[model samples]
Target: MALDKLIGLAMLAVASAVFTYYTIWVFVLPFVDESNILNSFFLPRDYAIKLPFLLLLIAGLGVGTFIGNVLIKKAEKEKLKKSKKSD
Candidate 1:
């Protein structure tokens, strides 16, 4: 249903946001002066702009989130169908 599709998209947005928020472990560290300072990202600066790696990061997260939400929706649909058929 249309509502199911929308729900799936919503789930994907939440998943991607959570992934980006938590996966930056290498980007922040304590400064030498014992103050809070942020470093660059996890990957090396030279590799950050490379098209392949950049695309891989974006595509991997996008595809993984999309597939996960779709699978959940499909399973829920099957469960509903089975319950209705038995009723």
Candidate 2:
């Protein structure tokens, strides 16, 4: 569908923009003068590394929680089935 294509394109564009900005902030900015006005546009250099690390940590936790929940539910369902068979 056209709508789906549009959404995908928009997401790709946004992702590309973020990647370019982050690359610049991390790799290029450090070499730039600290007193330059460009430095003010970005957060302190330390956060550029910390932010992505924090995001990855949170995403990992979320995935782990989701998998645990699904496994727990599946085990409960199997246990219930077994109990019903014995009844």
Candidate 3:
């Protein structure tokens, strides 16, 4: 259980870091230039994917993944408690 928690925390930290980087890059890319190298991220392309209203979708995905993992762990812990109680 301790190991699982540690791994989950580590993964969440990494994902958060990646999310921050992408968020900042996307925000600053346009200021750089219309044909700037950073423009290759195709962030604008994503805007028109007709998915969401903001460009934070990538970071949102990271957050969602982290939350899902955490919920799964919590459910596993609950199941363990139930099993022990049954015993």
The CA lDDT of each predicted structure is 0.67, 0.95, 0.76
Which model scores highest in lDDT? 2
- What RMSD value applies to candidate 1? 12.0
- Better structure of 1 and 3 per lDDT: 3
Worst 10 residues of 2 by lDDT: 40-49
Residues 33-61, candidate 3, lDDT per residue (tens digit)?
67777677555645543544554777798
User: Model 2: which residue pairs collide?
Assistant: none
Estimate, for each residue in 3-87, the C-alpha lDDT of model 1 and write its tens digit.
Answer: 9999999999998985674345323322222332444334443443485577888999999999999999999999999999999
Candidate achieving the largest TM-score: 2
**Clash numbers, per candidate:** 0, 0, 0
For residues 13-87, write the lDDT of model 2, one tens digit per residue: 999999999999989998999999999889898898799999999999999999999999999999999999999
How many Å off is the CA of 55 in candidate 2?
A: 0.3
Q: Which ranges in model 3 have alpha carbons more than 4 Å from their true place?
A: 1-55
Q: Compared to the true structure, candidate 2 yields what TM-score?
A: 0.87
TM-score of each: 0.41, 0.87, 0.40
Order of models, best TM-score first: 2, 1, 3
